[model samples]
Target chain A: MRSHRFYTPWLLMLPALVWLALFSVWPAINTITLSFTNVHQLTGGHYIGFKNYWLLWHDPHIRDAVLNTIVFMVICVPLLTFLPLLLALLVQRNIRGIAFFRTAFYFPVIASAVTVALIWKWMLDDRGLFNNLLQTMGFVHKTVPFLTDRWLLLLSAIALTVWKGLGYYMLLYMSALGSVRRDLHEAAAVDGAGTVRRFWSITVPGVRGTMILISVLIAVNAMRVFSELYILGGATGGVGGQDVSIVMLVQQAASGSDGRLGYASAISVFLFFLTAIPLLFLTRLNKNNQEES
Target chain B: MTATTAEDSREGRKRRVRGTGAVRHPDRKGRSPIFDAPTPHGLFFRYLALIIVLLISIGPMLWELSTSLKSKAEDVYTQNIQLLPHHPTLGNYGEVQNTIPVWHFALNSLTVAVINVTGNVIGATLAGYVLARLKFKGRKLLLGVFVATLILPAEVTIISKFQMITSMGLGNSILGVCLPDMIAMTNVLLMRNAFMALPREVEEAAIIDGANVLQRMRYVGLPSVKGVLSVISIFAFIGAWDDFLWPLLVLQSPDKLTLTVGLSYLNGQWSHDPRTIAAGTMMALLPILALFLILQRYFFRGVAQGAIKG
Candidate 1:
């Protein structure tokens, strides 16, 4: 190996190291420290030792957020995990003008989360296209309050998340599918296997590891739902103000001039642990996978 | 010839198989044989599924575009839904600006994206080169610092970041909004991977020629990593442009707000007129969409490489 002066590598890495210290490492430590205090947006405070966590434990908003997060995860993990694999399979084959189809599907993924949510919000407005179409078709005379209801608002956000997520995860699966045996389905077909049958026995097992990784990704992403719900359910979580997520709770606690920075830090610590469960599970699964392999 | 269509009609399919549904593979004619030549029914269902997914993915954005173009004469909301506008005009786009400084906010967003793109490209390139190519002590430990942060989702650290920005007197500033993400660890690691893939023979050859680290990197490493550099820059620009939560927390002044923050403000403050909101959304969307369209080859390639390596 070619030797370098002791300061050379350090010189090259200085900028990134400064950024890591200032942004990632320091903030991680400060978040835990600040959670023990009662800091606001404008004021610093002495440590009260878990009082903020105590309040968070009893907060009704936290309960609503927890319930909403669970709902978001339960629906999203299964749906996002399976649908994108089919989408990848659809676009993976070489056919006429396949490149155009592949890029076009990823448009929603490229668009900002705010823009798509706004587009969806406009479409689902009381007199918007969907409601208007329903009324015109004599399906319903009155408008549906999709954005105003608690459960519907949450569901609408989940739908938007899945819609935008399809192309992103499709890309991931597309890459993973590159390694799969191309002719296995044909062999399985001679055993009288149907399309779904081939998918379960062949494709699913082939990319079982990717599926597990994607499920963990979906779970973690679902827990961090913000822009979709924030836009669809209004700033205060629609009418009932209860269709909120954990990240939404973080934003609410630490936003505006009267923001509770300490309380928000506590909630953030909670959100961190919430996301870590899946990540830890993934690590454990990976270890098991390694042992088997 | 547009990139949107499933198949352009001008490229004639000479096979002329009627109703059997096997459209001749126009491009990739040679490799097509090695790939599965789908039967007529299979081709039909595949294209059908492709069309359906295409609709579900982009149909709303199209509807939003159509809604944004309708003139004042047309009733936006009616019992009989009319997708085709009676009269189309660009007035709603102007209305979005008059109500809020839409272009000004877009300019601010561009500034942030430009700064971030520049920062990530230059900074990550240096850090990645040293980490991957240079021999140094504690290099693995330095890399571990970068990898560990990937586990901490950016959002969880927002509270502390907000605190630090305020403490640094960067609150309500664009610099504050752009700082934390300027050298994202993901991009750095990606660049490191790219540099690592460079052939060791060239580096050895460069050393034999008495080329220092800078010259060796510039000649050997830089040229190969250019593709990945461009890919990460595109991602950086898009991330900075589309970002919401961080900008929302750090920026408070109406004038300094990015497009995302401004668009949301427009939603709440000018809660009337769906047309104007749609117009605002389009303005934030179109620039990045155009960039992605032009460079989608690189985008797909980058993501595929990223997925494989990751």
Candidate 2:
């Protein structure tokens, strides 16, 4: 009877387990299998060995994607890590109209990625609002190329990405902050620590676990950026000039005008690893942080 | 215990400092410096930070509002873009609906969100209760598996999930949008945390009174975790409602498109005159804003309580 009871939890969890296996696990395996095959339209192509991987390595577009993705990830992860912690700190106090502030911060989160991209696209347009506003304010004499300019485009994307994402991470940090015992804060305060000192000594250490978690989450998300970049016409997997991100390159290889199955697979395979490395490091960091906390 | 006394004294001091209606409102002046005491520079810094955050965060939305009110002629050559409209008009909103079927897209989003929310609530609570209350084998393993899913980025599986849905004929339907998301892992973790935080004695008494697992769960566990369930459901609703990529890939027909996808189509066309697109986008976001307002009070309290409980 006791043994039978052991299976009850598994039985209860069966639906979710089944859903993940069928929808998530099987599809991943299939994607890997399909990555190696040639596209024959109907029957699909024969098993091509490392031909795809080889082609992916040599392709200039694929190479550009790899470089671009690295740059975006490197730049974004740190910004993503710090901004939310800062926002969480700023809003950690129980202020009036906190709900309004929260909703305001999270508004971008609720806004569709497409809407976000569109709004940014309009603002970034040469004759658009951003440049016009800046021009009027004497910030710039001419219309700044927010989208068309290669360097500026990446920054704008990062800005939008950070804006959309900051609130969710802030909320997570806020909740984690709430869990911290007040005694530590009291102790620090009594020791003549300033607000910043108290936060560093007591609050920061208290939410160390959450910080690591947020870091891992942000790193993984930053590495896998696609839709917003894609929508911004960064679809060409060339060395520069739109299609600038690595995910875009994988996408181009997957379903481009070229239709190179092997190349697409290789690019995806690289991306998988690129994303995985940071994620692995992140996990280790989180575990270490949790233990230390 | 010592903290409480310290907090009370601080509260008394805060009342003294404020001086207006001090006795009536025992303000946060007590306790620790973190919550109660205001530094001389704190309000200035707070407002400055708040203003900066609001600008960075709310700047784009304000830009959208400005563009939406701009005339097509003005939009093309408007040199000075004040956040306030020169001449605000509902013409864009009027034209947007006629140009594209906005209501159809909204309906699709609503249907998907509603179904997804219902599925999550049922599955999450039941599973959460069992994980939290029942002494079952492999519970820790199951929890580990659920937590592991959080690490598996949705982008990695998008291609595969699309293929699965298309093959299953669930593609292009509202079912496709909701089905995959219905078995959400984050909410399961949330619900489990909420359930676990409920005192053990209630369940022990239920068991002592000869109540079975199902009965006890129905009467005690469900009620206790309802707050968490609402929060998770709201989150799920928002996620499903605002989704873009999945709907873009699956829903091919213009009529079948969700609001976000439909707005994207509008955006590409009206790249010149984006006022209409902005109006449409704002319309799409209105329902969510309304929902948040209606449940504003509960959301913060419930989420904070649940997180602390975890």
Which of the numbered candidates is closest to the native, going by highest DockQ?
1
| lDDT by residue (tens digit), candidate 1, B150-219 | 8898889999999999989999999999989999888889899999998888888888888888887788
RMSD in order of candidates: 5.8, 5.4
Model 1's alpha-carbon lDDT is 0.87
Chain A structural similarity (TM-score) per candidate?
0.96, 0.86
lDDT of each: 0.87, 0.71
Residue A184 Cα positional deviation in candidate 2, in Å, after optimal superposition: 5.2
Residue-by-residue lDDT tens digits, candidate 1, A128-184: 888988888889888888899888888899999999999988888997887776557
Fraction of native Cα contacts reproduced by each candidate: 0.79, 0.49
List, residue by residue over B1-310, the lDDT tens digit for candidate 2.
Answer: 8996797679647655766553344446434333455655667778788988888887888778776777655644478455677678778888888889899888999998898888888777777777777776577877787777665566566666665676688866877877788867777778888888879788778777878777888897888766677778777888888887667666766789888878877876643356787788778866787787787566666776663211
What is the Cα-based lDDT of residue B31 in candidate 1?
A: 27
Candidate 1 clash pair list: none
- Best of the candidates, lDDT: 1
**What is the model-wide C-alpha lDDT for candidate 2?**
0.71
- Candidate number of the best TM-score: 1
What is the per-residue lDDT of model 2 for residues A1-293, given as tens digits with 9 covering 90 to 100?
Answer: 23125567777777767776776567566667766766421234778877777776687766655666666767767777677877887887767666578778877776777778877877777788777778988998987877766667777777778878898788888888777777666666656677788877787788877776676667667777776776665445212554466655655544423345444555555667776886788768767868988
